[model samples]
Target: MQQKISDQLSTTAERPSGRQASSPRAVPVLTLVSHPQPQRIGERLLLETLANTGRTASLSRSAPEFSRPGLPPGQPLADPFLSRTPVQFAPGTRGRLRLLVPKDGTPVRVAEEPARGAREFLPEELIAGVPLVLAERVVLLLHLTRVPEAPVTQELGMVGQSESLRRVREDISRVADLDVPVLIRGETGTGKELVARAIHQQSPRREGPFISINLSAIPRELAASELFGVQRGAYTNAIQDRLGLFRAAQGGTLFLDEVGEAPPEVQVALLRVLETREVYPVGGNTPVPVDVRLLTATDANLEERIQRELFRAPLLHRLAGFEIRMPPLRERREDIGPLFLHFARQELEAIGEAHRLTVTDPRAEPWLPAALAVRLLRYAWPGNVRQLRNITRQLIIGSRGLPHLRIGDRLEQELTVDPQSAGSPHISGFEDTADPDELSPSRRRPADVGEQELLQALRASAWDLKATSERLSISRASVYLLIDKSSLLRTAGNLSPEEITRCFHECQGNLDKMVQRLEVSRRALQRRVRELGLGGP
Candidate 1:
């Protein structure tokens, strides 16, 4: 009677969330590839939804233990490789196996019990592999066939597989077909120009030239002539007729970077161009027609600048026909590892070396250790993707040809020196160690060096790490490590939740200003805001 009841329950639960069950005679088999661990792999598996509740089952050749926490009762466990072990499944046992396999072109086979027949599973099947329901309970982690790697594109130089990145790509594709202006807002180093280029490349204007100009780089006096072609003798030093960015990008796209930096006069000219699709060159009477699509990028809060009357409100409305915000590196931490690998490969290829270095290789260089990747993911990366790429290049070049390398050891040596010795000898805490003759007679370090002194230096340098490091005569890494250890990077004083909220509001939700005012690290301020339930901008 008990056996019958058990069988009935299994049958009732056999029906999946919505789909019909597979043939009863044909057991569901999942063959997972062995290379690129599942945690790091990005391939989507069939019937993955069914395994949502399934837990990883520990399996090994020795001792073959089956009874464990979360294990389904009365499910037959079998070792596919062990001939003596019989594989049995309860009437409605549903199971899914996650296997790791190699990417090299090779076939994988698993032996079946009783019949003792070996079945081969192809790579394509594993790539779009589906999970099976053997019984109500039964999930296995098996070693099986490998899945082929997903193809990567070098176009736009955007590297990431996270959902955030996918959405950005989708946004770029959707907007590429249109001629409307686009406004891209992102933190520094987030690749706004690359995104603009991608849109241009995908647009109907791909045959036309794409021109980019940094509004901040041009002098306020020459902004108009620089953007719109100038007539000869327009002004002093206007010796030749010059085609400006607007005319140069005539049929294509014009990418204006740091658009927020445009002067008020330049802003008015931009608004006119957008409104009339025409530009007036400096000292030129006729309006030159321009058919260029405009794409603008900025790291600043243009809305705040407008509120302060530093930017024109009308221009903002015209420029932002479509807006896309690129997420910072900290928000898409999962992409860091892959991006590091991508940058490393690019660097190696550019240097005319083999670009086959694998992160999984046990013999990989120390500076490129998997742990460093984890640390990088945790870092705030204030400078974002550009900083990561620069750091990767530095590490690769620094550690090249070294038989062994350990990042932790090097960082410790650089960061663990006596606090006083880390700064200049003229500082109060530091004792003069260098030769007197080597030191300039007129130059002197600060008489007092402490947390207060460091904070002052940081303020004076506008929180520039390199400048702060130079002021203290310490390595940049040491400065970072010291700042982190002493908690000097945190907001200076403890404030009530209300006070913190007030400060955040006062800063117009600008986290950078909040950091500066509070003398805290950006991460610290972000955390405080979260704890106080003060949502960020």
Candidate 2:
């Protein structure tokens, strides 16, 4: 057995050394070839290769791209991969396999054959949940026979390179290999679902179904049936038996978006499934066996909901096995330019507007000016990426011939209406003030009044720290502290973990608020929350 395994390894040569040869060479019993219509043609050749050699084979194709749907008008549609697929020759394929996109006309070689009786293969990277096993196998084969010179493009569409985004990517990379539930916390237009997709793409279960169910979008009456399946005769509208998100994602991922909106009963049912790895269909007698990696996301605070008895504690715990917080776009000001440029380039390419031009003229992309970038960085992005992309497209189309000059004017108009700035109320020379309530007999100073007014402003703004800070001409951190030191802490809700989180959120995550609202010092509050496994798990 050992000799046979060794012989197989020698024939396969699984690992490639640096800089493979450009030309295809024939071995004693096998040969590799390059095909022009690689994506479509390579699969057939791979079968031929494996049939002739009784060994593993692979096929390769050139990088492909396709325009993404659901983009707003005038916005550039993202194209991740247009054309390219892989074929792996194995007796029976099972488990996860990596997919690679190769440069044009690369030769594909066979390294290993599939194990017999293998029923399915998990793709290493996901393109809409379709396995790239055969396509990737081909690319691997080609790389072994002859390495390509150019680097491959791994993604199709989207923009922004903020540090917050980089951190998100790093976290996804770290957690993708594990089966832990991931909780993505972010506002609308923050791309929570996109992050989930990225996680699925980089995970071992990439080839299986990546099913998405918006917990908030589904009607209350239908949610249970939709999420947990239903018997054919379970309800008045039931015509046939159905599989739920759990079954759909049996070997892959189930993305539960707007998870905070799940009704209390649904939360309990979800918790049961999370803890048991099983689900009982609505009105069904038997429990369905399931294997799923749960990925949940929400903009609302589950902790607050739990406090209000609107969410289940156990469900929240199960969903938050790991947590990722998405920072709003305004906070990552540096990404504005790159994001704009990316959007503009995509739009120009998609419309074939620049078909005759090799390089885009700087003047044509007026929103890319250095001065405009500075202004964009200053204005807090209320709607995040989606908003920015829309504004960019608007600028591009609205400014027509005088793109540069018009972009500047449009940018100025945007700055004027920026909710962050225009929303603030001026306080003269408040920087020179101190904690002077100590000297006054009433134990209050003009500063105290100012602080209270700020808190009221924040409350009126619906606890939006950015708008509050902009209106007060102060930093968000300072406003966070000021709200706690003011009167808001006295009226905090009950002492549940969720309530504690709500109070802290209302306080903009200020340490002072945790101390005052919870009637505990900063350290104690932190320790208690951690001990209870509250907030972030």
Candidate 3:
């Protein structure tokens, strides 16, 4: 029985990497066992396909050494319990099979030659086990076990179980300990800053301050003083010595957001500081040393910016010691439901109404209906996670007393409406109500208002929600809901690039003032400016 089993399982194996083949006709064969089934038994099943060719699978409890650069010594790439050895099949061979079995002490073997047929062995026929074959091929030993439980980890304020997010978390873990500059790239509202904070919190600089700034928010003329500090008499308005972001973030991390919007001169200064590990305050000849881990984020294409001479190549190289790209919400739709629930719970708790909403099971009670969830998933989240959170807050607040907000029909109806007629009769029922907060001071609600009129009122009110609400004779919550549902809110208005530029100058490049003058949201204005290639003043 042993000789028959050996002959049946033997293959024309090739020599192992470091050894010579014992027989010229021998082929390499590898054996691997799947993690044990849910039932606990110690029997290893031999996969017929793998036994036909002699090649051993290579499984390790950690990520391969070659894939783990910058990882601390002795640190496993992933959870050891869940890790599996990778198997490499030779050319023309089929991929590996997921074979699993228990320790039933059954003798198993594959036919020596290929045949398109299945052979079954009775339990009593394979009582005696065959000896382990010693071939020139490498044999990787693996003990199959149940799927490992998720390891306890600091989720870093991120809530997602998608593969993309998992990879991001792993990347963060791998590079967190290294004191190197990191560049985060993602579309608008993808939470680049959150990733940066995670890195800082995981690093040695966790105890130090985390200073965050938006480069686009800083005017070109003020970039230098705002970033590297200003002497008491640096400029006409410099009445006091101010420690800028660099010094403020000493011994910690400095996150520069929208860095692609930085002016040419500021880019040069940044490159200098990165190279020297020091900063020269505006109007000061002395160079001040700063120990700050720099992290940068942008939605712009820096490589294109480099081609256009808008950004410095050396600075880009300096900041991008490691690059992490955050996947957009549309790409990770599976996370949307969980994110909505998380935000909804937080909103409910904040309003002291957690008990009013059912939280035990997501599939039932106060949670969004399945149809609404499907609608949400189907919609392209151009605004990403930030937009999702804002929409969730609006939904929760708007659905005050309802036992459950059935959004399927309402959302679908809103989707079919023409965006240009944002103030049409579609949302007619949301007018004056018994709630005092919903009542407008005008008492006479505006009727038949269109998108143009709404835009004009928003502009006249300086983008102030209260003022806009009053002008439209609607409740503040309704105004927000309108903004959320209206595509017109995001579309470019009648203002031309030249007109926006003139208004920007008139407002002295103050973004708030510019938004008010343009009658657009700050995000819309910035996006327009970027689209026009105007480069904000």
Total clashing pairs for each candidate: 19, 28, 24
Ranking by TM-score: 1, 3, 2
C-alpha TM-scores of all predictions:
0.54, 0.51, 0.52
Query: What residue runs in model 2 are displaced by over 4 Å at the alpha carbon?
Result: 1-158, 355-372, 400-537
Candidate 1 lDDT trough over 10 residues, lowest sum: 422-431
Model 1 alpha-carbon drift over 4 Å, by segment = 1-51, 54-156, 355-367, 403-537
On the 0 to 100 scale, the lDDT of residue 367 in model 2 is 26
Task: Please say which candidate is ahead in lDDT: 1 or 2.
Answer: 1
Which candidate number has the best lDDT?
Answer: 3
Model 3, range 276-375, lDDT digits (tens) per residue?
9899999899999999999999988799889998888899999999999898775554456567767777887887767644433312322444334434
Provide the overall lDDT of each model, using Cα atoms, as 2-decimal numbers.
0.55, 0.51, 0.56
lDDT of 2 by residue, 412-477 (tens): 665542222221111111111222422235432223448567756655555455665566655443
Q: lDDT per residue, candidate 1, 389-422, as tens digits?
A: 8877776666666532235454423222222222
Clashes of 2: 28
Give the root-mean-square deviation of each candidate in angstroms: 19.4, 22.4, 22.4
As a TM-score, model 1 comes out at 0.54
